[model samples]
Target: MQAEIGTPEAVGLSSERLERIVPWMRGYVEAGKLPGLSVTVARRGQVVFSRSAGLRDLARGLPMDDDTIVRIYSMTKPLTSVAILMLYEEGRFQLDDPITRFLPEFRNMRVLVGGSRAKPETVPAERDITFRDLLTHTSGLTYGFMDATLVDRMYREEGVDFQTAETSLADVVAKAAGLPLLAQPGAEWNYSIATDVLGHLVAVISGQPFDAFLRERIIRPLGMVDTDFHVPPEKIARFASNYALGEGGRLTLIDDAREGRYAKPRSVPSGGGGLVSTASDYARFCRFMLGGGALDGVRLLGRKTVALMTANHLRGDLADMGQPRFSESSYSGIGFGLGVSVMLDPAKAQILGTPGEVAWGGAASTAFWIDPAEDLFVILLTQLMPSSTWPIRRELRVLTYAALIE
Candidate 1:
């Protein structure tokens, strides 16, 4: 269902201030810093501000719009986390349960003790990796591209990247199991393939393929029509081009919408970063979270489960774990929850945000945050690679909050 569009004043925000987002976003497109962008803001279930700028396809001159589908990347994690919690409510698995119960390969795991990538020394893991470890990213798993540690090198050697189309989720997990973990289970926060494992677990426990489970259980229920693991033939025209900053700060096409791998389905559906969605479709998902796991009378999770998922599960600041190489959010006042980052202290974060705000961004410069405090949520969609390339999320937050008059 489409959200009801309303004036900012209706939602207790200044219409004049909300209009500033247009020029601010247009400046990036006009300067050729971004190919295109779309922003959506909703308050109390009404869409207060929604606008798009620039082109979805530069060559074709297709402008970005509400329906333009883009790769959401790591934003897929929150959905995956929600799916896990849905199954948890059904008595599928416990948060602290060892993942080895279903995926035995994770049992008797080894951690990198002390050695080089060529011949890494290892020791047995202190304990089996649990669902909490996977959810909180403390499972010792590491993304191959995020760091250059020995385990990360091993991940590279084992073909542990997420872009592959041939390898299945099971195949990737098996390969990852053979490689030594970067740290012991629950040792420290390491953004890794843990969510992919959770995706595989979703398949294992639900007895359905990961994509099938997500589609039938979550996507369809939420009415996220344009969201899926791959863009179909008819929807190809609506898919946005993925780009990266090139030499001398020019937008370079990195993935073509029509010819990219996302144009077709893959065996391995990356739960951590492998879904495509439009601004409206994703806003629906965010609205579901904001509604306490329900939207438009369709409840995907219990309200208590939603509360549990958004709560800060981490003991202290995420920065204390280690310097985060991927996420742009300040770790000082941030703590991780099931699949998204939870704001713990806005003062220490030095960002215009509230505690209990749950959010996450994608690798392709897309971000969404749910502010339960203000009954607000914002979605910023774009096609730039390495979300860190620009401080758009932080700036968007400032722009969004400054517009609130009430």
Candidate 2:
């Protein structure tokens, strides 16, 4: 079903104030800080504000539109997490179940104790890596690009990067399994390829290819027709060019829309950071989550399951884990849920957001947040790489909440 488009006033927001987002966003484009951006806000299951600015392709002068598809990167985690919970609801596996139950490669996993990149001292893991550890990123895995530790360097040397198109997901997980973990299981939260491991488990449990299971069970059910691991031939023109700030602060083309890696099928469907989607398509997904895991008549998860997924699963302050220096958001007053971040205290976060808000973002400055308190959801899509390069997410949060006059 199509979302009912309504005036901002109908959803308890100031229409005049909502228009301010356009100029605010256009300023980033004008300053060459971003190539293009598209934003959508929905309240009470109705779209209140939608806008786009600048160009999707700088060279071709292609304008960004409502339907422009852009890489979502790490935002893919939430969807993969939901897929795992879906199988959990089907009695496939318990949240605390050892992952080695299915993948024996993970059995007797070891943790890095001390050593150089060439040779590392290791000790046996305190316990087996569990499904909860994977969902909350406490499984001790670490991404290579985000850190400079010996384990991270090991990840780099092993070709553990998610952007690769050559290796399969199974192979990637197998390689990671052979490496010593960055920490003991459930000891700390470290952003890693745990979601890709979950993706492999999804394939194993569902008896379907990872991409096929996502398309069949999640993407199609919620009517996210344009979301996929790759853009089809017909939709290539609508795919946006990815950009990164280069030397001297000029926009550099990182990924071309017409002939990029995503233009063709990829061998490894990166559940950690490899999905492309549009503003509308993702809004529908947010609406599904906001609707308690159902959209229209399709129900992907139970209401209780949705509640559990969004709740904070952390035992102590996220800061206790020695939060990664390169992380985009502050760890104080924030906790990891199944796949998203749960706001334990908006004031501590220094952001204008509600407590219990579930949110996540991608590497390309794309972000989304679901506020059950206000019955609201917002999606921001863009093509700028390294989302940490700017404070757009925080600015957008303030911009969105300030417009809620009601």
Candidate 3:
């Protein structure tokens, strides 16, 4: 599919800047690398640059429209964390509350011991899993995809479904409960199914299904019309196909569309990885977070709560927090906040930005960062994998930051 080159005036973008970024984006498409891409940058609550490039569907040769929806994998975590924090603001619960306060199954959990393949030794949990641990990923939950250890292998063997699978959130939690934790709760950082478990807790605490609570609290108030776990019939065609690098440098389409399983009201709305959203819709969320728990008089969280959520809550060696597969990537040594990654040291993070810049991405290569110090929020969307490997993000950050030079 050919690229849609909107003039600077047509899209309210700076022509020179758009022209500059377009080549890098198009180069990948022209090189048979990426299939579809869309990026939007906002400054002080107004979109200064919004551009859609490449084909949304390579088979049909559909151009990526501005409104095309992309699957946002882990990016859902921040929003889910916010919803959880909103409950915190309502005096519904405390961050330090043991998760057992809501879910009893986790009350007396045990940690894995001996060898990776060995059965977990029954050591009494030193402490109960707290809501904060869930938020920061300090809770010893494991994502089946990121590792290949015994427990991780077991997670996959049992089909620990993330975004693409048909499993419900309750199914995920029940499976997680049976698995041995990699470490004691709050003892070390290991990114796991902790957020998905938090989703179930959200359901248990709010007395409403996770999806309903999120809609009633965050999505509705923020005007995120196109953000949800499933897409309706009308929006399905515009949904971009998931793409990945294939043999011999070819781009192959992988179908990730939601089946009927996700279409109906789901019992498990994954607080961790169950959201599909557009660049614009997600921008509203990023904007609200950048605006300090409020947007246009619609405040979803208290200013103090938003501040706490973004603050670095990790202690001890930051490396103990979670073992990211991409440890060498810029996010290494970074701290996890309630639902997002907190940049403790720009030098340590190796990203060209200020400290305290909170960020997260989805499995489908969707990413966004809220730089409160710079008053900047940058969101990039694409249906692919290994989001950090791309130069688009780093270059975009540099370009965006360079433009703000005083």
Candidate 4:
């Protein structure tokens, strides 16, 4: 394996941590586990290790560069969550306010118990799905395809179209209103398009398009040049090709022919899964949050708001749906905070990390975690699907934690 630090991007990181991360990156690529990756590590607002490895596109033999843009799917959620908090900090709305206050269709939402018809089982929600619930995933929203409950199946049959390339967020939410909710408001922890709902709310409250609001408030201020819901035609060559395993164990390039805002600008801005960002740019964002919401004099939120976003909001019995099988080497019983995953029980988590570490990932093999206790954040970005089931993410986290001298 080969390793080298290009140059010191900044200071304040232990040389030991930089030395440790280099080999893990080399080993991961040498083993042909990841096609290409961009890794960035930071401590107290300074970058320690920033490097790129492997080929961005295996077919065309495109070498991975520092400027490779990647799809950060659900990682966009934290940004959306921060946008919501910004509005909260502005006193636009309270966390406990019913979603119907902005989106009237959400008022008389019902839960689906049995069949095609809205069954005999029905009850008024004890409380409205709050802004806090949107952050915590306790709002009882289902992703439609992940869980195999009756409602999930119905979601697949009816809701899949709205998530497709042509459908807009408004179309998706309107369809969602027609379907029965998985549970009462703020009841169980179900991962769904709640952030998309927040995107709509951002439109309502800010009097601007969701994407426009994000661009004005967050993206432009942070100088995130390449971060956006769509990749412009001029920048298409910079976008990495997403890949997945196919029959006979051959690595195949996944089809990305789906349309709308991802490849080209569209009016429907998705807060849930619509963002393309580069490593350095996203690192700036993480640094802002890790530094308690202010970066380079641009404060998107207050320090206390940053704390509130990362706090453990899961009540007694209602937490994550179940412990997801991250990989053979790791098990996570983590719960959702506002927009990130909070490591609830380190002992039960069976991974290498401190408790209170806030983390989440994108669908395209990109993941990151910020450990406030250690004042450290690590980001790994790649363009591959089905990334959660792989062991590399856990191993990377384990090695990162092991490198800490303190």
Worst 10 residues of 4 by lDDT: 1-10
lDDT winner between candidates 2 and 4: 2
Candidate 3 residue lDDT tens string, 186-282: 8776666778887777788888888888888888888988888877877787777877777886877666444434344545577887788887788
lDDT of 1 by residue, 57-142 (tens): 99889999989999999999999999888999999889999999999988888999887766789999999999999999999899
lDDT (C-alpha, whole model) for all candidates: 0.91, 0.90, 0.73, 0.73
Better of 2 and 4 by TM-score: 2
Assess every candidate by TM-score.
0.98, 0.98, 0.90, 0.89
| lDDT computed for candidate 1 | 0.91
Cα TM-score of candidate 3: 0.90
Candidate 2 vs candidate 3: the lDDT winner is: 2
After TM-score superposition, the amount by which residue 74's alpha carbon in candidate 3 deviates from its true location, in angstroms, is 0.8
Backbone clash count, each prediction separately: 0, 0, 9, 0
- lDDT tens string, model 4, 1-406? 1112333323344566566666776676676666678788776556667778887777777866777877888888889999988999999989888777887877777776556434445556666678887877777667765746766666677753323636666777777766667777776777777888888788888888888899999998887888998788877777777778677655677844233236767556778878889887787788788779987888899999898888777763123444321311232456667888887777677787777788888777789888988787888888777775366678778666665665
List clashing residue pairs in candidate 4.
none
Candidate 2: C-alpha lDDT: 0.90
Which stretches in model 2 have alpha-carbon errors above 4 Å?
A: none
